[model samples]
Target: MNIQQILKISADKLRQKNIPSTALDAEVLLLEALSKCADEIPPAPFLKGGVLANDAPRNDNKRLDKNWLYINNNYELNKKEEELFNNFINQRLKHKPVAYILNRKEFYGYDFYVDENVLIPRPETELIVEEVLKILNNDRREQACLFPTIIDIGTGSGCIIISILNELAKNKKDKIIHNAYANDISSEAISTAKINAKKYNLNKKIKFIRNDFEKFLNKKSIYNSNEIIITANLPYVKNDAYKTLSEDIRKYEPKIALTAGRDGLVCIESLVKSVLKIKKKYKQKIYIFIEADPDQMSRIMAISREKLANVNLEIIKDLSGKKRIIKLLYCHPELVEGWKAR
Candidate 1:
């Protein structure tokens, strides 16, 4: 009958469903239904002080109904809103991520289309992107003319590489000569990545290749060193790792996109070794940015060091200050001409 009454009903339903962040979920679902961003929704106001649908001012009435939590808060949901809200809750109960249900995911400050084919992009991956951008932005030698080639390994949905281009193209539209590459072991994942790329009209901005990391490495016999920047969000979740994961993840997402291997370093091991050999051929340096499980980093670094001698290694931490990205640089002492550290 009122906003307070509707929230009570929805919140109770969510809690009973064992949904974490029940209140927040209810609020978001309702706000999205009305096509209103979270900021536009009214905060919980005075205890039961809000007006009813009919009695409330007309402008407030429409906005209020969109606030499904306020159902009867100040407006009533028309049929369309009612259908959407119900479908939203049904999907959530089945453990579908909100982004998946809405067919959208926010990444690097932009909303990207999503579907079952791609893993929902996480905020953590953005840390790797940030580190890569930091190195590019800090270069004093002119970021404009230098076309920095970038490759995203195991590029699920192409989120990492695409986000980098999106951010760069947003600002320095001219420093855009570099080729962008995205590779995924799974054909389906590659399809998903291409869809997102096409949606952004970045088909020309990035090249999508359906190949495994090992295959790509084997194929990189003639790559130039100065022309490359490698970034990856490898599946660090150990093969033995999935048993411990929540049912929500273990059941829904594609296995190839999640589990790396027996030690979770199987693919990573191959990548490090491949880069080491490639550096010799290229003669410049490789900017390596990657995400690894907390415990796996030490082993990854050790393996990388063995393969890449004299490579400057820096560990990147996420916003929460957890080490998430490993940035490795080659040719340290011989910093190219006017260039320092990149």
Candidate 2:
């Protein structure tokens, strides 16, 4: 059959299966199938706005309008390629996420290896990386010039830490010598993270430590440096809410990476307490950046107050105008007083 016919039929099948982005999904699957079969796609027609009849209605019959039929009739797929494309379409119908099907996701302009073993990186988490980079570039700490240890807690897929390191490597002005660390509780996650790190040639630069938060806490001697910058996008989805997530996420992504405790504040709270303990033991200032649901702000703030009285805190909101990242500047109480008095 022609390209149009296959896409229409596959999209119709997906529509029937209640796929949200039927047309887009059909296009991606078909293109992926074509690339997989080593087909040299023509650039003349398909490149010049010949893929989809963007103006066509969503209904089945309307999907095969004149604009689409012309392109479809011109482009045809062979038997084996057609079968492969159909298989991909079927998988989409099964509620599998596109990223998992592709086995790669673009995060911070870099591709990261992902699968069922680790949580798929989301757009929202990009804000965490951006904020951390900003802090590193402009941090006014007395030890700022010294190379800081950049630690990513629960480093799923190693996207955040690797992306940060990649950006730092590109920054000529700073010329910083930061040590990178990827800490995760899951062996599977650490394995996947290391793969991505090596893909970007950052494996040697980053130290991958497979341990839960508690174990990492006990082995604090590794972080002997005075300037420490810690960032974590740990499991913050509530257990009950996790059950209600989209089918693709609930079925495919790692549950351990998506969920925490009842209120979704378990990991974040534990992280806050751990950072406090680390600060007390090392007697050094620590900069902590955490990503959490907006709803958990008050509870997180309450913990900060109860545990770290007189701490300097900043809440950063994402593009959606919801609070997403929490930044804490841990200074001595006397330092805090001096800054406030100034």
Candidate 3:
């Protein structure tokens, strides 16, 4: 059958299964299948009345867009494409996420390799990257004295830290010296993250450590940098809430990357306690950006205040105006009051 006919059949099947984005999933899966068969596929069949005369400009690249499919709705899929597309549809019918099926996800406008081993990057998590960039760009201190180190705890697919490094590299005029480290407890996650880093030529720009964030923080080497920034997007889904999540997410994504303790604050609280120790021992300036469920922001703020006295905490809301990011600024005792005034 042709593109339109097959898409309708697949979409109808997905809709029956109650998949949220039925049409989109069908199109994307078909697009990927077509890309893989692009080399062996023949040209489009001749139209009877020059039907393609006013069609949108088609992209010659292997990954064709939805518009290309629209213009070629009558184009039939070859045997290989049909088999692959059917397999993808079957996976979706089982409630698997499209990202895992594609083995890729886009975050901060850059694509990262992903799989069942890592959590698929979410759009809300991009706020962490944006907040980090703002801190790096707004620093007025002398470049010579500022050795900025960015540590991403529970780095999963390394999307957060890699995107930051990619942005900094793209804007070369910012001459700040950057040291970056990413640590995760899962060896498979670290391996997956490394693949993404190398994809963007960032293997050397960021260090990947195969350890839990708590243990990784104990190393004395990270404290050498005077200016430290930490970005944590740890698991914050409560145990009960995890059960209520969509089947696609709960079934496909890694459980280790989701569903924290009962309160969903286990990971965040531990990280805060560690930061407190770092603050007490080192007089350097430290900034932390954490992404969490909007409902838990107030509790996080209270935890920060109780753990780290005089902490400058700010809550940044996502586009929907929900408090999704917690920005913590820690400075020397002398600078705390001044920092708070701003």
Better of 1 and 2 by TM-score: 2
Q: Which runs in model 2 stand beyond 4 Å of their true positions?
A: 39-73, 139-144, 173-175, 333-342
Best by TM-score: 3
Clashes of each: 3, 1, 0
Q: lDDT of candidate 1?
A: 0.72
Preferred candidate (TM-score higher): 2 or 3: 3
* Model 1 lDDT-worst window of ten: 38-47
What are the per-residue Cα lDDT tens digits for candidate 1 across 1-342? Answer: 333555567778878877778777776677666554323334433424454433432345344434334434544455666567777877877777777777788888877777777788889988887877776665553633455678888898788888888877777742643567898888888888887888777888787878877678666532543556888887778877789986557656767777877888877788888887776756555678878876777887888888888887888777888878888877634546436444
Cα lDDT tens digits, model 2, 1-45, are 877788889889988988789988888777667666643333323
TM-score of 3: 0.93
lDDT of 3 by residue, 1-342 (tens): 999999999999999999988999999999999887777667556554676512433335447778778778888888999999999999999999999999989999999999999999999999998988877765465543676888999999999999988888887623574578999999999999999999999898788999989889888888887889999999999999999999998888899999899999999999999998888888778999999999999999999999998789999999999999999998888656756786
Estimate the TM-score of every prediction.
0.83, 0.86, 0.93
Task: Report how far off residue 66 is in candidate 1 (Å).
Answer: 9.4
RMSD of each: 5.0, 6.1, 2.7
Candidate number of the best lDDT: 3
